[model samples]
Target: MHTTQTFRHVSYLWDEAKALELAGNEVDLFIYRSNLLGADLRLTNYAGGNTSVKITETDPLTGQPVEVMWVKGSGGDIGTLTKAGCANLYVDRLKALKNRYRGLEFEDEMVELFNHCLFDPKCAAPSIDTPLHGLLPYKHIDHLHPDALIAIAASKDGETIMKEIWGDQLAWIPWQRPGFDLGLQLEKAVTDNPNLRGIILGGHGLFTWGSTSYESYINTLEVIEQASEYLNANYGKKRAVFGGQKLENTDAETRKARAAELIPTLRGLASSYRRMLGHFTDDARVLEFVNSNDLDKLAPLGTSCPDHFLRTKIRPLVLEPADTLILKSAEELKTYLVEQFEAYRADYAAYYERCKHDNSPAMRDPNPVVILWPQVGMFTFSKDKQTARVASEFYINAINVMKGAEAVSEYVGLPEQEAFDIEYWLLEEAKLQRMPKPKSLSGRIAFVTGGTGGIGKAICEVLLQNGACVVAADRDRLDDVQTELRRQYGKDSTITAAIDVTSTDVIAESLKQSALQFGGVDIVVNCAGLSISKPLADHTEKDWDILQDVLVKGQFLVTQKAVEILRKQKLDGDIVNIASKNALFAGPNNVGYGTAKAAQLHMSRLLAAELGPEKIRVNTVNPDAVLRGSKIWESGWAEGRAKAYGIAMEDLPAHYAKRTLLNEEILPEDIAKAVLVFVDGSLGKSTGNVLNVDGGVAVAFVR
Candidate 1:
């Protein structure tokens, strides 16, 4: 028997002093309040909630006091909402839109009018839910998607239960796609009730407000706390969840390993147009739901909350029952996935056709955004790590809501027609259109060896600039590289790990890191190497062995390990090996280094031929005399090569440049660009090739 769990209250984080500090201005207090409310994932998922404060500001043109409203803007998260992120609009102009509103059918037009109401023309764009805050009569208002309140709102007996908990303290409204009509409905409810503190939108979320920011903030917390009390009192004691657990969870490590093995394939299929990054989570709550007998039934019902649906899609595709999943072979799982993908796409298209309006933007991506494997975990894929992570969190929110709702009354998703209406809404289409275009390598993940070294670091930088999630794997100096990349690109775009390419075990760990951090790897760059130049008679046994180990063997092992992830994706992948111009030029006193480079060059060609059927292209960038930002040069290669030429150490760069047909200095950035060419989708048909970034070394050129 499951014991009743204690009611955990939403943290009351309100500090009176903090509010008082910002009380002089409504906008400041509103931003403050929004930050507090948005800080808790329990309060609202990323960008799911909106906050507004109707304030008095001086008109820039008229120099007179004007009533303005600031609401969290379209696609802005309240947790990080700044003044720049809030849409500032004239109140009179917003109310003026009411005259233009034809009916619920034409509510989308209201969004266009909101821009005209902007107090500043460059202010943030307003969302469709703007009127839900603007047209309201309160000075401060919040539209939040608290899981507890959404649980009640999504339940079969939601409104009835609300009446029981707060009686006349809160009002109820049936589910309505947020627009002018719903805002008016809200306005009327508050106008008529006169005694209600908040309103719960059926199968949607919650609405709370007060005369001041503090009051509104407190009201939101109080209402959620009250809902928690009621739900916890009834949840475990009332009935079994998701028809109760039907499968034992695989251990956490096993679940993660399975996800790592599986997501690459799913990710490739999902990336029909643009590749997606993945985030995996095995929150106990999610595992419970995944292990439950009702997973198949409930996951397909999708999420009731619009925000949840927007992140998680209308429904999740459950792969198999937890207990019997391991019994199936990997090939069986893969075959099943392909069939399901085709079926899901067709089904999504049908959904769009059934619900699309004549003016609806053409159907969006039909691939599933959320996938569930019984007893394994929930996996979400998006264009970047942060978005993927947020989606996963939102689905977990959906799970919590479902658990509480099923504990009392059956949990119900938004009606299919209603769900379609919200999904294909023109207002949302505009939001999607307004987003900045993706970079060249958006959603692609790359693992860079020696990522802290000069050439490796340059490659990582270029890849990150092009929007690839980079795992900068190096045996040393990872902390500095990770901090620099995080500072430059934010936490979502890059991660660094300490790894040795020579060890298969270490290489496997790097790929696992990539899988967990940003889905799977699509691009692999072999740049970890050292150079040893000496007369054949002077080269020691240790010198030859070390060069081969680090240069030839390391590159081989790195590519060998990453090929597993690439193969799993069942998609196109790129491996660029950094050999050297010396591989072909036969420079004097370079036996140890030249031999390793020659071996690397041929190995790349062999891998290219072997992996061609899998769409894994192998290529090489042979950089000659790359002295600028080179660790090999810093150690001894520059002096050794200079000695071979009977020239000063400082004279080697100019000597190499003068020797090339183009007489150009080959920088690390130049070599980095070469690595990019092989994977940037430009040379799709070209592979088993060598690009000499030697500034035109005629002697090193391939025949």
Candidate 2:
């Protein structure tokens, strides 16, 4: 509640026209749109930050030069800003002295300052720190909480913590209130250190200002880049042991039991918040954290940043129940409210009174944002769609950071009252009611073979959006696939396994591990088949064996093993085989591949016949010319096959395209979706059928 405010002159202000001129000539947004040479710059180079410019114009009525500030609004990362994201504010009004502030209360001053603000009236409230940006004297200013700054801020004793690493080059400040106070503090710090390149606010973020917007933005990134490099080199080993321990314990039964208990609570929370959130409970981090011994200690540590309190309450409700019933959970929450808050009932009433506006409904029940049951895990609550999503993201990120911190040291979170203060802050509360609408397939599960391949990877993304847990398996040990999947789907929702599909043992193990991790598997898309382009005369015994093993034998092995679990669970499961157009029509030098694919087609028919009684459908998707960037293309299979057929590889694709009525290059994903149709139960009674996903390549040819 300290209320001292200060301002500084940047000493290099430019007019609006000059600002626009600078933006047009040097901003990457203009460059990217103009198809200019700098478009290839890394997209993240300037993300999660903002740039602003000040324009002074004479008000026709007032006879005064009114300074209007144009600042980048929220939602976009600064590195990727375009023209539309810049918000225009009444700068002169923003910088105006408080009318009755000579002896005004803090709350009154805040109310008055907020009332006169005229920026992005339609959007959620302008950033809470708008006052900080207004007071900077520079025409253009840039700010970023880059990963490097977060790394330093996240550490214990971050000021002394950073000094050991950054030397004396970087300036540091203790954490403080972000708006008028932060701006004033920064002004003083800069004055004290006139040559200061940047300021790092311990536990808050980083700020870099300059004569122009671009220089400030670039310098912020450069400073963060240096910090990142230093951190990577110096303190990177801090969590190595913890990470290793977590990984080593991944498959332990104790971990699984803990995970199972947590999943139901998470699922209940997700289901309750279904309208507002995307797929939330299925993320791997949630799964992993719930199963850990430190979940109770970990959950709160991972909550959203100070800004996230409005969307999610300060801390999720931790339901350490002796029983698993919802009634018990409710009782536990009530008890916790009393135990945790000295004047729980009064505070709840006061909170509602403060937040309720003229027509706004009474605040929803004072349930916790998330709940952690004893053996059952955690649950998150939201009255509507947007709050749920915000809660979910906040929870996920918080848990991840906490888990990460726990690896290096004990993760003691911010005091509960402080968290409450931030969560109830007016600016943050608005975000809680603005959660994103839920997505389709918000909590389904999918298993994909060849997920490391481009086509398979694309399909995985589509399934993820539709709310499916994805298990991506590949024959190669490309850990990059796992890393990328985790990046997109959260570690829990995506599981990667290395398996040679031809080996029944490997397939069985992979299936077992997946079932154990995700309760059960619902959809299976078989994309593990391979082909060898070799003429009938030149086809070696070894080549034929390899082709038959992967394309034919492997398919049978995987399907047979998964069938038992699918049937036992009574899940009307679907299986889609990636067949080849060559299975229907001959392609020169594809003697071994074509024969194996034909065998796979026949096998799909036989499996359909056998499994139909159990309501487990089987089908095949035959695709042609899906060789782009695949092993087939990279290894010159299409070129070799075309050469044997006295044609060019480029012409080979066209020849197949013309054979098909649509004349399109059949992508591997096209085949995957056709397989998905059967897996998704779209083909109700259409088991054992071969769906041509080859863009009509097989239409002209008769069996």
lDDT of 2 by residue, 384-435 (tens): 3234454565555455445434443344455554554555545444555575
* Model 1, span 154-199: residue lDDT tens: 9999999999999999999999888889988998998998888999
| Model 2 ranges with Cα > 4 A deviation | 1-65, 70-72, 76-86, 95-125, 131-305, 308-447, 451-499, 503-523, 532-544, 556-575, 581-595, 598-619, 625-630, 633-690, 695-703
State the displacement of the C-alpha of residue 133, model 1, in Å, after optimal TM-score superposition: 1.1
Task: Provide the lDDT at 87 for model 1.
Answer: 91
**Against the correct fold, how does model 1 do in TM-score?**
0.94
CA RMSD of all predictions: 3.8, 11.7
